[model samples]
Target chain A: MVHRISLVGETFVFQDLKHILASASLLRSGDELAGIAARDPVERVAAREVLANLPLRHFLTEAIVPYETDEVTRLIMDSHDEAAFTPISHMTVGQFRDWLLSYAADTSSLEKLSPGLTPEMVAAVSKLMRNQDLVSVGRKMRVVSAFRNTQGLPARLGSRLQPNHPTDDPDGISAALLDGLLLGAGDAVLGINPASDHIGRGMDILWRFDDIRQRFDMPVQSCLLTHVTNTITMIEKGAPVDLVFQSIAGSEQANSGFGISLGILSEAWQAARELNRGTVGTNVMYFETGQGSALSSGTHHGVDQQTMEVRAYAVARVYSPLLVNTVVGFIGPEYLYDGKQIIRAGLEDHFCGKLLGLPMGCDVCYTNHAETDQDDMDTLMMLLTAAGVNFLIAVPGGDDVMLSYQSLSYHDILTLRSVFGVRPAPEFEAWLERMALVDGTRLRMNQPYALPNFRAGS
Target chain B: MSQLAQDPWGPLRRYTHARIGLPRTGDSIAGSEVRALQAAHACARRAVHACLDPAKLAVGDSFIEVRSQAKDRSEFVRRPDLGRRLDGPSIALLKQIAPAGPWDVVLVAADGLSAVAVERQAPPLQNAVRAALAHTWRIAPLVVAHNARVALGDEIGALLGVRCVVMMIGERPGLSVSDSLSLYMTWNPHVGRQDSERNCISNIHARGLSTGEGCHKLCWLLKSARKLGYTGVALKDESTNMTLLPETKTP
Candidate 1:
């Protein structure tokens, strides 16, 4: 059976759960819903009624731990006063504590009845220890979502790196030159590791802040922020902007020693929230692709490994959960689609299965130049959409220009008008006056129109 | 100084010249010197074509022949797609030779640049393929392409939709010899792919990596990739020294 446990409440249950809870009489340390609900008589009466009607063990097994199995049957039979175990019997703050205390004392019984109790129970209880942390994360995701929406408008009002020779110029996003093809997409633009030893390079770039301000008209605060050892603290200060560019290749090398570390996401999300409180518009960009770049052909590069595709998939699987965090929207080094059957298979398994529950409005970035065409773009979009990518750094004018560039296709615009009660962008009176419709509904391209900055985040 | 330093491919430009083993034309140089370049080029092309054509070649869209002419005639473009498809006759030939659909993996070799390398390496590669297939593995339809590169295997794999693909391609002919082979592998078929996705087994030749040793390594890689689902960047073959393979003799 697949074991799915939250990381939140694990530690307390494993280490000193019974000891800590007994000493700390206060069940709700700081204003959890259980504490408030306990004080309300009306809610308590309703809960008692439901509990009395419902089978207590059934609810506990389904909600608390699905694999209680034989433990539930054994626990009920062992209890001498089986009538006391009725659902209507209210578990008061004290009674709940006593019951837990009794449960902990019967560890020997638990072990005897359930042979799989020792390590597995420890792991399950350990997972529940992170519940305190989960509450904070849930609240933070909600707040960051609101903040991301609020910062959306004011930030889009200005320009970014200049368009012409945009890739050449480090800061050419604002004054875009020809079209959306300037830097290709966000991932391709920011995913490059041009400077080796990023922390030192970041310091070098930070030192040149005065020169950068003089050279470009960007805001004084619009500096690039990278995740160094002290990145979270740096984000709080609101000086250098943040860019999360961890090397997938480097991480793949680490997989041998460190079996999948999921704590990195919580740490990054916590850090982003801390920084968001101080800074209004976000200057953070995420990049975690290009895991296969480090594989050498024939020559051993010190790492004992099998093939490149394995490393890429390993890296993706490790980082999949972290993608759900609100701070991260950009992802790339999207070289997995390269016509290698093995690598593609791994990508399908890991990416398709593991990556769900992505934060709404997340964008996928492709870092390196795959020279991807329309068909490639379509496949990538379908894959990302399935993986829950709402926003993407699409190839401008590459696929259907209407969907990619204008964010509206003929069918979509018509559907919006008829079904959703929304009109097309060109349907505005001023826009209609300026634009000409050729084929009844579709607007024919006559004069060139500059792309309105559709960057979602601040 | 930085531009000079960054030019990794600079030293290779001088490596380009007419190959050896052709009849004396005495066009550019006197006697033996003129004949040497011609011979080398002829030998290289012959070797490449010999391995590629006989063992089934597929370009982009379909399978091809050792010495087939394009009906469209404009197919000699530098781009990937133009030279991918094979003519009807070559496709018919491939259909006869190619195994049925949904193979676990396929092995393909291409002339790429030097046919001499293909000729020299084909026997060892065949030996390796036999050794791998001896395990009763479900093998895919292997095909050859005319002009190719390392990631060209990715393109072929993508087009074919095989489970795994390993393409043995000709390395650029060097002064020492023209018959050097490189092996590239991927999990699923991907065409028009890049370097950062797949793994490679390169310099598999009599001089560098013995064909037997290359075969052993490829087998090991194929097994691991199948088990783990992907390979290339994460595979570290630091176990036994490849140079110490019992069958290998230094050229």
Candidate 2:
């Protein structure tokens, strides 16, 4: 169905729902590169106006990617909650936006509406909203999930201490992990992006994280960013697989490009939960996503990057993920282009993920070539924190040596915690207190550092 | 880098290349740290936009130069699909230089994201491959693709009707290592093949995967892929456990 709208005496027509979604996106290079962006700024606004009038149920009836071909579309259509949708059943996308902002839609109301909302519906409504609107609404909804400690609590910001090593060196990773842990980070988890694809290396790193957590008796878990299949294989080898991690995308073809499927993820998920490693709760999956991934893999299906990105949240929410992060700038300047575009995509991703009732975090990051710098990251980190982002990925100096990108550093995590008056997850805070790392909720800057067995042991 | 003041955390730099424990003034890293980071970014940014000097790229080497469908660097960065295929003239050039039937493998080098990596690393890797496979396999002429991505190899190989394609391209330039190269090998070389259908060996640099070690794995993969009739997920590089090379630096 071609949607038409006249703006300032010029008529703009979008060929289909996907076209409307694509053209209405906050100007991103990925859409333009996909050749689906609006002809001009006027058409963008025109498309947004058309999208705002469409009822939320229209998304349920019309899928951007056909349900016959894509399992992700099938998941979205088949899993939508009709009962939860009844309150805003008659509302247009614009009305839904107002409802999101209204006093009636608090945390509980948003929770009730979470399963009712599909990615397409949320992506459509987001096009009509600005950065502040996205933040204001997203800040209201809290998506609490847990494993060793609770995440997504209000007035709390969890963080993953990403102690990545270029060569998966035990001493190197141990040193980075030691630094991050000393700064009172890693309340979310201690994760690493191993340089080698060999499962032995991934398993070796996992052992190191597990050993660190066990020896310190810290309220944290361990994860290695390897393939889901590798994690499943590790599980068979009796490796301590705390959270099964994978990079997911919007399309079936894109997921295929990663050599993963819903079935494969399910197998890994089952294997992880069967380990029964959680001390507090049982949310076992951790997923990382980014916009333009589908486009990068040549499986975008003409959908805009942001919409494609929001679709991944639908997939994440299905598995009851403990953590879902969007590596906002890691795809580089090709998709996002500059700091302005990266910042916009970051806010949109966080807001949309929260709306889906998934524990949303942002990898407030940029590539060196992406026309963004540390200052832009600092700005995005501050904004995302205020928007009630569940967590943030904090590497040692925001420089991820293994991944070849800059992310929010461990020091940035300290800044966010201090500036926003937020603390790490409660159980982790208690653990830090026992270690004399905290002085009444504030991290002690001058503590005597002693991890004698860190570099050499286990 | 102030004349009198030095980085207090300098001793901790031994374990990793990651910049950690940077000194902060007021929620921001010190200006010295920022400048150090800027220097790294400057080189990386230059690597992204740097043009491949053909004379320097092919020194005492007869490289059949070609260009991707992307007209220039800007289009090459944005339009990945265009960079994956050859231009009209490039296609014509490849067709003219090749035989009708299949060869064992075709090799193509590309200045992908980092011209420094290609100019510095690809020649030695090419020599190593030629030395390893000259007697065993029917190799095609080395093609130098400008403004290219990994899949450009498939197009050149398909035009030559080769069994496999070895794409040597620049990996994205990181701060610590700007001139790292990557190798991608695909059997049944053709258009529209997924990245999952190929095997990759990235981070070929002085500090990372050594040239000798890279060749060892490549020979093993080429032999296995030919026997197995594929090169992706089904094939795994277990070269580390095998005692083939005299000294192997396990990544």
Candidate 3:
């Protein structure tokens, strides 16, 4: 159907829903690169004007990537709840935005409405929203997921202790891991991005991490960020697997680019569940997603990157992941351009993920080549925490040597926790007190701190 | 550097390059840490925006210079499509350099995201790769294009009618690493190739993968891509650190 709108004297024509979604998005480099962005600023508002009147049910009727060819699309359609959508069925995209920001969409209401919302519906409403609107609505939605620790609870912030090393050195990882723990940074998990996918190397890292996790009796889970297939093999070999990690995408084709499928993911999810590693809850999947991944893989099927990003949450929602985050600014200037765009993208991803019933986090990072810096990350971090995101990835001094990208530092996370008056996961916070790293959200002063001890074995 | 100039874990930080256990003031890092990051950002800005010093690279008549459609650094950074194809005059120049050829591979050295990487590392990597693959492949003269991306190699190779393209370009700079380089090899080089249709060897720098090792891997991939008649998913990097291993003395 031809979607058209007029602004002043100009008449704007859009090809379809996908085209309108791309045009209606705020300025970002990825949409422009896809050649689907509005020709000018006014045309963008015009596209949004047309999109505003679109009935909420239009997203359910017109599949963005097509339902037949894509498994992610199939999963979304198959899992949607007609009963839950009835409350907002009559609202247009504009009306839906007002509804989300109004008093009617409370904590329980959003939770019940989550299953009925498709990525497209949330994405459309999000594009109509301002940053404060995103924050106001996103902050109200509480999506608590648990493995060994509860995350995304009200008045709490979670963090992943990313102890990534260039050579998968145990001593190096241990050093960073110790640094993270002292700053109260690993409430979500102590995750490592191993340099290589060698199975022996993966199992070695896992065992070393498990040793620290066990000796401290820390409530935190541990993961080696390798491919899911490698983790599955390690699981078979009796390695202490806590979370099965993979970089997932919105499109089935792009997931294949990562060499994953719903079938493979199901197998890994069930396998991890069978191990019964969690002391608190049973969510066993950890996923990292980013905008432009599908486009980067050349399999976006003409959908905008923002919509593509939301679709990935659909895939993540099916598995009930303990944690899900977008490596937002790490995709670089081609996708996000600069600090302003990166900040907006981070908030949007958080809002969309929260709305779709997933525990969302943001890496809040940028490459040196990108025209952004620590100041921008500071803004985004404060925004995400205010929006009540589940977690943030904290590494040593915000520099990931293995990945070679800058993210939030342990100190930065501490600052955020201090400013927001939010604590770590309840169980992990108890462990922090037990270890005497902190005296009720304050770092223990002048106390002789004992760092972690690694058993002398690989 | 005023108070707590010394980190308690300073000795253990040698285990990794990651900056750990920074001195803290309340919940924030001290001034020196902030200054260090600013210094890195400045270095990286120079790496990305500074003009290439091709003279420092020591190229001769065998190397031809060209420009992508992107006229400047800002446009090049923003418009990737412009960086992936050569300008009209540049295409004419490439055609003039080699009117027609059945070369095995064409080597392209592009000043991608970081021109500093190309200025510092390209000469060593390009020379080593050419010398190593001289026997097995009929390689073309190095094509140095400014304001270019990895896909720029495709159009250059297609115009030269080469079977494969080995692209040595600057990777996006990390905070502490502004000059790390990367190499991408693609078979049947063309204008619109998916990233999956290539094999990438990244993180080549002073502290990362060495030029010698990068050359070895590229040569191996070239040979494998020829045997398999493809480059991307079907072919795998079965490379190891055998070159760095201590040579067993043959008694």
Interface RMSD after interface superposition, each candidate: 24.1, 2.8, 2.7
**Pairs in steric clash, model 3:** none
Whole-model lDDT per candidate: 0.35, 0.86, 0.87
Docking class for model 1 is incorrect
Candidate achieving the largest TM-score? 3
Task: Give the number of the best model, judged by DockQ.
Answer: 3
In the range B1-251, model 1's lDDT, one tens digit per residue, is 77535542233222221111112121111356435434644443344334344432212444333222322211221122334444456546655554456567777766655545665675557555655576667765446555554555564555455778787777654333556788878787565455655777877777577787787787777778888888668876553644423463323
Please, what is the TM-score per model?
Answer: 0.30, 0.87, 0.91
Please give me the DockQ of candidate 1 compared with the native complex.
0.03
Runs of candidate 3 exceeding 4 Å displacement: A445-449, A452-458, B1-7, B60-62, B99-107, B124-142, B161-166, B183-204, B208-251
Better of 1 and 3 by DockQ: 3
User: Tens digits of per-residue lDDT for model 1 on A144-205?
Assistant: 11111121111110011112111222232222211221221121121222223344444434
Best by lDDT: 3
Q: How close is candidate 1 to the true structure, as a TM-score?
A: 0.30
Query: Residues B1-251, candidate 2, lDDT per residue (tens digit)?
Result: 76223643454567777777677665556789889988988899899888777676554567789999889887887778788888899889888877644578977778999988888887777777788888899887777889999988888888888999998888889988888889999999899888889999888888878777777788889999988999998899877643564553322
**Docking verdict class for candidate 2:** acceptable
Q: TM-score of the candidate numbered 3?
A: 0.91
Give the poorly placed runs of model 1, Cα more than 4 Å off. A1-198, A202-278, A281-358, A361-390, A394-458, B1-251
What tens-digit string does per-residue lDDT give for candidate 3 at A1-458? 88878799988899899989999999888888888777889988998898899999998889989799999999999899999999999999999999998998899999999999999999999999999999999999999899999998889999999989888888888878877887788988899988898999889889988977888788989988889999999999999999999999999999999999999999999999999999999999999999888887789999999999999999999899999989999897878899999999999999999999999999999987678889999999999999999999998888888887889998888898889998989998888888778876797532114653443212
